[model samples]
Target: MISGNRSKAWRIISWVIASVLILPIFIMLGSGLSATTELFSHLWDTVLPTYVLNTLSLALIVAILSSLFGVTCAALITQTNIKAKNTLRWLLMLPLAMPAYLVAYLYTDLFDYAGPVQRFLRTTFNWNSPNDYWFFDIRTLFGAGVVISLVLFPYIYMLTRTAFEQQDQNLHRASRLLGLTTFQSFYKVGLPLARPAIVIAISLVLMETLADFATVQYFAVNTLTTAVYDTWLGYGDLSTANALASLLMLMVFLVVLFEQKARMNQRHQSNRPITSSHEIILTLPQQILASVFCWSLVILGFLLPLGLLVLMAIEYASLEQIDELVSTGFNSIELAVYTATIATIIALVLVLYKRLHKDKLKALPINVSGFGYAIPGTVLAMAMLATFGPLDNYINDLAANVGIEEPGLILSGTIFAIVFAFVVRFSAIANGTISGGVEQISASIDLAPPSLGVGRLKGILTVHIPLLKSSIFIAWLLVFVEAMKELPAVLLLRPFNFDTLSTQIYQLISDERLEQGAIGAILIVAFGLIPIIWLNRNEDKA
Candidate 1:
């Protein structure tokens, strides 16, 4: 009876947490749908069409460019006999650690007319005026797409490379036995098989491109993300911002649905691991070209941008900047700690309930909780405001009725809102990681505990907790890193005078003074790299 009561309590708690996480999203969507048509009409007549168009165009361009860069690089690394394959393989993933906005700012500074590249060009040819040579502008829509793809293509490259490496080798051998050459075999058999991974990768790129605000904002390219930010903060129109955020959320939902549909019928699994003999041998010229191609991605994506930041830090380091960095770094660490701890705990609860519970709806909480991952940070921020703004008002009203001192925006305007948003936004990461870990333990282990006279809660604490230590640590670290780097949600939800490393760097970038914040930017990048390095190490061990 006690075990049954405990299980029931766990289920109730899991559902309550899931509902709380999901409420903000539903409120935001409903609020937008129920918004006054006049606001919609005004937006439609003014800048709405342009924002929607620019958003769609950017997503398309990013998808195409990332597909080209990622698929080609993955192919070269997996299929061809590229020199330094091992080094290039992990180096390609390093770009994932570089944020898109930083790359945009660095590249623009480097290639702008007044910068060294154009100055070198003019000096080389003795050209005096702007009309002497036409330089490709790095501040245009296409340029934003390129800059974003530089950092994001690694998502595609990493997955697609794994797919290629895991493809059934027997199929390739059969193709070789037929009239197919190495390239032909890859095209006909390998590429077709890896289509699911490529599709999923591109979908991730699209979601990220849609979520992007700082890059497009810096480039003066209007998108829904920037529109939502402007509508809320620039104009102080929460209703209008909710409407815009809802629209963006709809786009992300479509992408998620499309990704699901694309993979619903696909099943590509293989027992055979790719071997050395199956690697395509390239001629000397082909070898150089492939090596150059792979190395160029690493250089342009991560190494060059990182080198620029290092140079800036060396040139512009100052005592005042270090003082400011210390303050903002503390804020970032504190915020990340709160977000990671809460998110990991929630993940543990939902995953464990699903694992041990006998209810038919056992999976519902975890499924609903993960939906936040697809919601962009801008949209999630709007959702938090929509949900919490009124709650804070109600609490204040109740406090006044009871003759208590009123709390001022405690939920909406304080760190509570920011931490809640972070947990909602990143719960999926923790869920997926912890769930994967939990799945590794045997089902019989649960029985063993009960058979040994251990209660469910005690068994979980002593047995499951110890076994999940590694997974729990990883889940916590991943969420911590993401929270430290997350900008949009925190930017919208932070209290007055509050700043984290990402926000501080974004402000410096906005004011064209990133040099002063170079050390902070490097710190953010270093945090971003922790998970990538961990992932690479695990892959090597596997």
Candidate 2:
């Protein structure tokens, strides 16, 4: 009876936590319907069709490109005896450190009509102005999608490479004996078995693309996420913004449903132990080509922008602006550390709570919490406002009722609001990484502890956590990098006069002070790159 009661209490706590986790989404949906019906009509007439087509087209293109690049790189590094394969593997993932908006901004600075590339051409060939040549605009949809894919491919590459390393070698030998070429063997034998890894990576990229507000906006792309911002801030139409956001939610919903369906068809059995019988020794030409491919991605995604920033930092070395930048750097670092730590703690609790009870009630909350990672930051900020505006009033009402009212807590306009929004937005990263780790640990461990008469909490701490130490570290690092690069949510939600590196960069770029913005942008990327390097070192162990 005591054991049953303990389980029951834990179960109730899980449901309560789950409800709080999902409250933002439900609040957004509720507020959306209560807004104007004309907003819905406007969506159907003007923006909905274009938003749907653009978002879908971008997603499909990014998915294909990222998968090809990621899977091929993983195969080359893991299966083939390529020169510098170990170094190349980590270099491939370095692009994750470069934020999409920063990439777009730098490319624009490098290649735009008024920029150095065109200026050099004009001075060299005795050409005049903009009309002398037709330059490719980096502001187009195709360009934006390409830029996004370049940085985002690392997600697929890292996960799929690990999957390839862990794959069962017998499957490959069996396929080869049955008559398959090297490439064909990869598709038939390797790809199918790595489905789980591919699915997770692709889903993450899709969600990131959908959630991106800065990159799309900078490029003037009319994605649903961008529309969410334009409608709310540009037109001051909250109802229309919410309506557009609801449609965006539906798109996310469909994607989630498709994933569930696909997962249902998976064959979960004992994986054959992975081993390799044959390895390819690449020719010199092939080696050069691989080197170029790897370096090009690193340069385009990370190095060039960083170089520009270093130059700008030198240019601005004399001013107090450098000191100000350093101060803002502190704010950004502190916020990122706090956000990552809190998010990891919450994700651990949610994942463990769901795992221990094995009840639908607890599972629902964990799943709901995960949804926040998918929502666009702009939409999330707006949802926070809508939800909290009335909430603050209610708090004040209670304060008045208690006869101790001075001024109600202004949570929305304070640091508390920014941190809370960050947690809500980024909890998914921690949850996903930690949950993936939990799944890898054998369920038998949990049953073992109970059978041995250990307390449930003690079992998790002693057995489950020790096993997940590496994954927990990786998860925290991933969350830290993401939080550092985050801009849209921080921009919309931060308190007055409170600035981070992201906010500073965005402000400078928006004011057309490209040189100044490049400095802060570079700092953000540098911080992000630290984790990429760390993860690469840890990848073999993982």
* Model 2 residue pairs with clashes: 18-365
How displaced is residue 345 in candidate 1, in Å? Answer: 0.7
Per-candidate Cα RMSD to the true structure, in Å, reads: 1.6, 3.4
TM-score attained by model 1:
0.97
What is the C-alpha RMSD, rounded to one decimal, of candidate 2?
3.4
| Clash count, predicted structure 1 | 0
Runs in model 2 lying further than 4 Å from the true structure: 1-9, 268-270, 355-362, 397-409, 433-476
- Quantify all predictions' global Cα lDDT against the true fold: 0.91, 0.78
Kindly report which residue stretches of model 1 are placed more than 4 angstroms away from their true locations once superposed: 1-6, 269-277
How many clashing residue pairs appear in each of the predictions shown? 0, 1
For candidate 2, lDDT tens digit of each residue in 223-342? 888877777778787766777787787777766666676567666434557465476667899888876776777677767877877887778654567777888988888888988888
